[model samples]
Target chain A: MWTSRRRTRAALVVAALSLTALTAACGGADTAKTAAGAAGGKGGGAVLKIKDPGNSGPLAVAKKEGILEKRLAEVGATVQWGGSYASFTATVDAVRSGSINVLEGAISPVLGYLVSGKDIKIFAFTDPVTDPAAPQTDGLVVKPDSPITSVKDLVGKQVAVNKGGRGEYLLLLALQEAGIPADQVKRVYLNPDQGASAFATGKVDAWWAIVRAYPEAVAKGARVVVHGRDLKDQDLNMQAARTELLTEHPEVVRVYLKVLQELTAEAQKNPEKFQNVFLDQGPTAVSGPRLTDEIARTRYAKVPRFATAADGAFVTDVAGIFQKYGVLPTAVNPNDVIFDLKPAA
Target chain B: MTLEKVPLGVPASVKDPVEASVTSVKGPPKGLTKDLANDSANDSANDSANDSAQGFAKEDAPEREVRGGAGATALEPPRYLGGRRRGPVASTAVRVLVPLLLLAAWWYGTASGAISSEILAGPGAVVGALGELVATGQLGDYLLASAQRAGLGVLVGGGLGLLLGVVAGLSALGEELVDPTMQMKRAVPFLALVPLFISWFGVEETFKVVLIAVAAASPMYAYTYLGVRGVDRKIVEAARGFGLTGTRLAFGVIIPTALPNILMALRICLSVSLTGLIAAEQIGATEGIGYLVTLAQQYYRTDYMVLCIVIYAVLGLLIDLAIRGVERVAMPWRGQVAAR
Candidate 1:
């Protein structure tokens, strides 16, 4: 019986090995075809590669609605959306390596890339926070019963933020404007959920939260101490692509930007529809109503036809803040990185 | 090929030399000598009777040597003992070479642009970042905070696990009560319980430490219970024959016998504790190695991230080596057996 069992096992192993060999042979051929297809797109019928960060944002909504793919198809191109990116650096690295064609992220990371000497170009502003009518997304908040009433009271206290990103930048800006020495206030690095919990539990004196979280925090008896919109005139979001991609496949880049512009306009005009799209297609479990409310609170700046001189100046100023905080090693020239797209004319 | 005539019929004279050498080299095996010595000592009160019963001729009887009254008779040198000794320096070199080669590969890959530094920072960049963090005193602070959390979690959780494991392993009622609950907990992934842990303990140091402790406890309980229950029945019976009972029996026989397994369990528990600690710290820590890594990730500082990962790996190795050291001291017999 044991011998029979051993023989059967050996036979099974042989069958499995054969199956694996067959599959691997097929896979190799498929990989070659994919490589060829990806290369072919450089001149014509190229696939427009974009990354989804898995957030309930306009890009995610557009992807879910099939708007990007449909629009690209009109220009004799196809859209290739990759898996959720872990970080902006990963996204940009993909674009630089030609593994991806486009990425959308905050301006700080784009500035970071420019400082690092990567050849990436800002094609369009996705969600610029330059409009005065825009709902305040970034803010500092304090617990209801806490003695820390204002940014001034936060001196010598711990404030929670997702350090080295937008949250830290906003909090530092608030502290600097309040005339509080940087050394006096301690900035505790925590992610949004943890920051909320810390603030609610009094582990931190205050938390730096975005607009979506502000209403939730207030409902939990936390009050906003300062809003980032009030402190600075800034463009928070942008779409970036490799400089090579811009130069070689301007048609693809233009189509992508056009789609993003339309989405931005649609999100502004009818946020509920955008919210419903996000609720159905977003990677998170955020409810439709909450997402709608967040969209309602958000106000987007007018989409620029191209990255202008003023946009470059804004980037330079943001880079200066990053450098001053030691987040950036040195200041970067925004003009060196920002590409003024002329719509393939 | 043609078959040659066989010479198998005339090998008697040739076999003599081989026989002579074999006889010269072979002596009574160590086990036989030791057993004989033990038999002689047990019958020391009747030496003549022992000699007569064993039929040892007066002229051919082996000389006996007693050491420390344990009846350990010296015998011919063990045949495998005369080769050059294995040096610690050679083993240490081998141990160090693997990591050095890996480091070299990483450097080469990055320098040749085979591996993008943007995706993973090269070792040179990581070292520079390490030096910067150390100079600014951030690395030291983060390391201290992380070490404290891991240390406290291991101590508290390990103690509880050891106690519960012993209880469950020794008594049926304890197993019925505690084993089921622990088994259920072990089935749940540590990360899945994070939200529940946060709600229950709040996002404070308490929550982080408790999360690590809970994770550390599961492996400790499993291995300790197995070690205790796996004690040799024959040895326990022999120990019981000596009238040992209760705590005396447990400490004197079971625990010592289970020391090796417990130390092994400790190594695993420490690793699990570090993993849990890192995860917990990632959430709300104001300052820790995990926090440093998180912040580096946000800023896209690959060098800083790699440096923090290397720090974590080194910490794990150091902790594992410390447990191995404890195993060496606690179970010297293990080393003797390994040497043999």
Candidate 2:
């Protein structure tokens, strides 16, 4: 009888558990409804969900200056910011799920999503990679005392990089040009923080990472081991959106890109605005000289005309690298994944 | 059930008394007496001849002695006659029904198509993807590499674990010296150590394998120590009475007695090692099963990702099954307790 009661009790417990699960499952449907409401000018006004992974950079400035939001507010669109440090996966998931309309980072990511059968498009361009006299937007650095003086010296040494990003692809290209097969060098794929710590600790011989850390590494006695230009190629990382989102809301896309260009102009005209944004989001109190160096390195001070064929070729070439490096499934023409708009003439 | 005439057949103790009784009831009157005499003669020849003429004294013997004494009655000992035997058919049906039911529910849930494929892949797609991988020979290569690493780690880890655990269990000084350190090591999360290990070992295969081995060693060490310590003092004393001492005493008495616990530790270690190895492979290696999962995710092959997870689950289950088989072989005395 006790055994039978135990069995009955177990059944009851299972049923109760299932019912609780059902309730949780039902809650997902309610979330969709809330999303619909949020989409339909609910939440006190028109709410726009923007995903910015870091508080640093131009987005930080835009947030503090309140220019983009102010512009959107005039059109009845209330802006909300969400940040993540979870890599492109998180940002891609958000945009693909329609939880966010615009992901402000690398445009090269569209090829990744496209290979996965996503119909997303790059709606706007962000940072530029020009300004050869200035510091590189992306570079490989090594410890000051280390023997790795050039790209050729990186052979048989560990170099930290993110697998899909421009850093890894460019690093591959740099190694090839240096007459080193990729297999000769061990590539340690890591996120920004991991790569940074590894580089700082001398765990990795070199770091192929974002340019934001280039000056910091230099300050810490890690030399500008290899610039992207040393490899003889250019890769542009930019802001983008789903093609459907751009098509249905061309006015919003146009206005957003125009505001971005205006912000770039504003930042270039006054370096303090850029420094304030960097300080608010980072290791505070960057010095005047350091700020100038950072400003100089922040090459997107001039937003590139994103619709030109030259720009299209640049994106296409990067996508091809993504394929060659095995990060992307296949090579996709940038035109297939981009929507061209002549920046309001 | 009335008391029947006692079957004079084998004095009701040899060939089954029940079967003899039935035979007696069915036999012709002319053959009954002759058959009964022949059965008694056969029983006496087999039993008394080999029982050292202690056949009548057997009733006072231990239960084990009784099973060792004679014919059909000895064959069906308390152990043999206990527990309902589950037929192959019922067991097979259970095995088939359980996974099939789970697969059906999964298919139904995913095919309803409400859930995003990225978060949760459909069963059909996962199956199709596995078939494709298998056809492409990639699955075989990945599995081989992963299995080799896991096997090596388990052996090395389990060996070190047993050695240290036994030493720790035997001496208070050893336990005092190692216990706190072991506990601290176990407390540190395995994933956090990956970056450090990668830094130290540079994503080499040795580092990956050793990392997993280290992860596996902890639980094994703890379990083996506990198992050795938990051995009955009386059993040690009893073995010592027969001149067994030190290593012999441990191997012959303590280890056998603590075999179940030691095996349990090994099982836990196997699983922990597998988890650590998979995580290590995921972060760094270009080839193992975990690398395949990452590679698939990079390409947005949801089906292949699902397949990798399924393969991992199956490997874990198979390891557990192998452990159970070893347990049954090592502990024959278990059958006696089950009878009780």
Q: Which has the greatest lDDT?
A: 1
Each prediction's DockQ against the real complex? 0.02, 0.02
For model 1 the local lDDT of residue B189 reads 84
For candidate 1, lDDT tens digit of each residue in B113-224?
Answer: 9986656689898888877777667778878988888876776677667766766665565678889999998898887886666566545556677788788888888877
lDDT of 2 by residue, A1-345 (tens): 543343234333433454465457447645875775566674454445565423235566777777678887766666666433134654565565555667666655456777775557765565455566766566798877889888888878999987677678778878767777778889898866467667766789899867555565666567777777666564665667667656766666666677777766776666566664533311123555666777665534567445555577767777776666677787777667677765557
| Model 2 per-residue lDDT at B189 | 78
Clashing pairs in 2: A121-A243
Deviating ranges (above 4 Å) for candidate 1: A1-44, A53-57, A86-98, A126-134, A211-215, A278-285, A298-305, B1-340
Error of 1 at B232 (Å): 18
User: Total backbone clashes of model 2?
Assistant: 1
Displacement of residue A327 (Cα, Å) in model 2 is 4.4
Q: CA RMSD for every model?
A: 22.8, 23.0
